[model samples]
Target: MSTAALITLVRSGGNQLRRRVLLSSRLLQDDRQVTSTCNSSTSEPRCSRFDPDGSGRPATWDSFGIWDNRIDEPILLPPSIKYGKPIPKISLENVGCASQIGKRKENEDRFDFAQLTDEVLYFAVYDGHGGPAAADFCHTHMEKCITDLLPKEKNLETVLTLAFLAIDKAFSSHARLSADATLLTSGTTATVALLRDGIELVVASVGDSRAILCRKGKPMKLTIDHTPERKDEKERIKKCGGFVAWNSLGQPHVNGRLAMTRSIGDLDLKTSGVIAEPETKRIKLHHADDSFLVLTTDGINFMVNSQEICDFVNQCHDPNEAAHAVTEQAIQYGTEDNSTAVVVPFGAWGKYKNSEINFSFSRSFTSSGRWA
Candidate 1:
């Protein structure tokens, strides 16, 4: 494989692109029918999405940083084998996602979901560091590994833990077979959400990417970001004979290399407490007033707070549009990293298609209204 092929490998298809469009603009009824018209008969439903193609440049994307040496010389790669299939079925009851390559030449973000059964659904987001390989690998293989190990487990947390470590070990085996030491360096953060019975949500996360729950329009955090700057993380790194400090970029990193202490494939940093163990959380959904859930990488979280993000999502009835709103807001706020957002709505929020609603986001933390 060459660099161009590698780029295509990771950047090509969304398999779930249709689901994003469907859920981002329409609402699923109790009877399994979807409607975008909501309760209004006068106005047309907003179905347009914010897709970044070769079109007009977004003002937020700085013009100076979009090229790289890989454009001319495509590096040769070893023969590749197809990864596990994307979840055979989609549980598009109420889920949405949006991602932007931002100023980078290649996008390292990947997200998808699978409906294991009628009542069980799995969602994931992977943010790659160093390159898109690790992210793509996790996005393609993590859930498959999870489902394969599902029947043997009784505890959700234990299952999630096993799945993550299993992926780490599989990647290690692949690296050895391919003789690709680079795989050990290219790592990604994994954030997976499991929705059982449509009301019970279990999230497993490693690294800075987060999952936030919006209950009655309030932001409730579900996962803790695994950054080296955190006190416990810093102490743990020290215990492992590693140091944490701000690099020239003004960001914290362990051993001046990897920033997040926990990830899927950063094998080089694993000795320094950079393990793949994921933190898990369970959330019970309330149908009357409880709203959607938002999962995003640090790109969005760095620019927007949980409260403001929840407020923005509350304004968009469609989860995809909600995700787009979050990412667009992050870019507008000048978040330079590649941004991605996943919105999963339930209960009243699943059908709150108030078409006339529009919202503006705040660049800084003030309070939580739609008036930034």
Candidate 2:
């Protein structure tokens, strides 16, 4: 009786040990599989941020120092503390901006970038015509208007549209208060971008200022010019008693005045369908493919097309360098308007850089004056 009881206890203990061994083996095997996947050359590349170490350092998007020497603005903090995960640091130091007066007596192009909320960032460019008043007002007030609306509105597109319309109304009121009645004619093309959670990109634009995204060495335009050349825009203008007339260069203008069918602070042409309503586009960013986002006024756009700009920026080492290169190139290409460019780096900032060089010996069509 004693021998049989002892044997039964031993057998039970053996079974428990076997079960523990099997479970440990399975756990170890799962870990090995993950390691293999991360290290495998055939498998998709892995981001170093997710490959954690015990160092406890926060993830960062760029190591580049502060871009501007004049303004000592703070760099953006990582979202890890708020999001409960290691989100990349989106720093203003990594962003680039450049502006030139070009042939204009005074630069009417304005651009800015800022951290709007914990999870959102703002970038914008404004091209003013008739005067710099509209661009100046937008550059100063656009971010504040969007920030004020964010607590009440979650949809960025709606916030941008409302902000634009509100700014237009406010500008009209401000103009009415001024002794100068001609402020009503001051108008600007506004292009604004909001980047949320380092992925969601929403852009709102009125007139011809553009926002372009570069993904995998390719350019994806985020805005369409609000010109009378577009059949839909032309029809809308006509319905509002506005007529489209072309200049000597075949560039169409609304009511033979404003070049764009939509803009901010064009109170004098309000009845002629030059509205302040913005067209918005939202995109989910893929960090592995998306390199950067660039916002430009027509000065750069008219002289250097999107692809050319993308290639030009791709050759640069950092966002700040890229911004200067694009705008400088525009001036070199003979743009007579005030030129401005802002470059914001993304996850693939240095990943998809262009190794091949490009050359442009031919003068720009505008400079050559061969409108044919």
Candidate 3:
């Protein structure tokens, strides 16, 4: 058989299997509904099949306990196919971002989020150092580079990897065209994520920027910092004939310059083991347990831990408020750096309410409201 024909046949079989699983879930839900109905009187309303409490009302999208009544948004496709019930769509309208200059002379952080394709959503955070040129370039071309590779690559992981390398090469060409030697030194931390079919999440990151997920009121870090502080990263740098040195603040730097082992630019440091290659991760999202994806630059990450950020978000009404709250709080805590945060609500957003969170302003912040 031809390759295209075989690919079509495989997809057809996958669809059939999905349909079978969905049908089974529906049958199970129908049986529960019947039992719940039979157990109650005609005047009493039936509770939701997924409802933890026996509330006497039919389950709406709100039954997931994710959304606020103010939004009243309806569920989109894909996710419903699996649950045999409605789950609210993860929309661009629900994505939120906040960026602040803080004590920096220039705000060097950049972030973007949007629907990249019909089935994929894109989100990224770039923390620029030395200059904003690299971050700015990435902010403009990263999405396009990823979309260009999506048609050729079936796996999202490969797509992200190729996109990162492509964008890094593109930045080098751009820097050369600008005729600015300083642009070569400009580098940025890139943490990019793609959500496909509302089920698969793929994240690729370099440098110290991070992508974190909130699942069932807890924090799950999706990316790790690619810094000389990591033993493997340090060893890799040493193998490349590079050395690690500590700054006055005791932060390790590769070759006594760049703090990270990987980045998007910094052409001068490329030979010293500061590479553009990113560490990538892919995960299957569980809508019922996964609440949102939060992307942050080291500015906020250095000041606020992932659990603290997650709890703060859980206390907010929506993604927009959550993003602003986290960045603002980082500044309030005396971070002398640019602070930026992007919050993308998933199927389980707002499921954990304010009452569920035990956050204290004094607990995370120091007595002088400074970074401790």
Give each model's whole-structure lDDT: 0.69, 0.78, 0.80
Q: Looking at candidate 3, what is the lDDT of residue 285? A: 76
Off by over 4 Å in 3: 1-71, 82-87, 354-372
Candidate 1, residue 273: Cα displacement in angstroms equals 1.5
Write the residue-wise lDDT of candidate 1 on 81-119 in tens digits. 121111111236557899997667888998887776555
Best by lDDT: 3
- Candidate 2 segments whose C-alpha is farther than 4 A from its true place: 1-87, 365-372
lDDT of 2 by residue, 1-372 (tens): 134422332233223344235434544554566666665563454323323452423322222111112212222233332332223345788899999998779998999999998889999999999989999999999989999999999999999999999999999999989998778899999999998876679999999999999988899999999999999999999999989999988989987888899999888899988889999999977655677899999999888999998999988888899999999898777788889999988756767667786656466544634432
Instruction: Report the C-alpha lDDT of model 3 over 47-115, residue by residue, as the tens digit.
Output: 444443556433333433333333334444444455343345567888989999987899999999878
TM-score ranking from best candidate downward:
3, 2, 1
In terms of lDDT, model 2 sits at 0.78
What C-alpha lDDT does candidate 1 achieve relative to the native structure? 0.69
Please, what is the TM-score per model?
A: 0.70, 0.78, 0.81
lDDT of model number 3: 0.80
Higher-lDDT candidate of 1 and 3: 3
Candidate 2 deviation (Cα RMSD): 13.0
TM-score of 2: 0.78
State in Å the error of residue 241, model 3.
Answer: 1.3
Using TM-score, give the best candidate's number: 3
lDDT of 1 at 149: 72
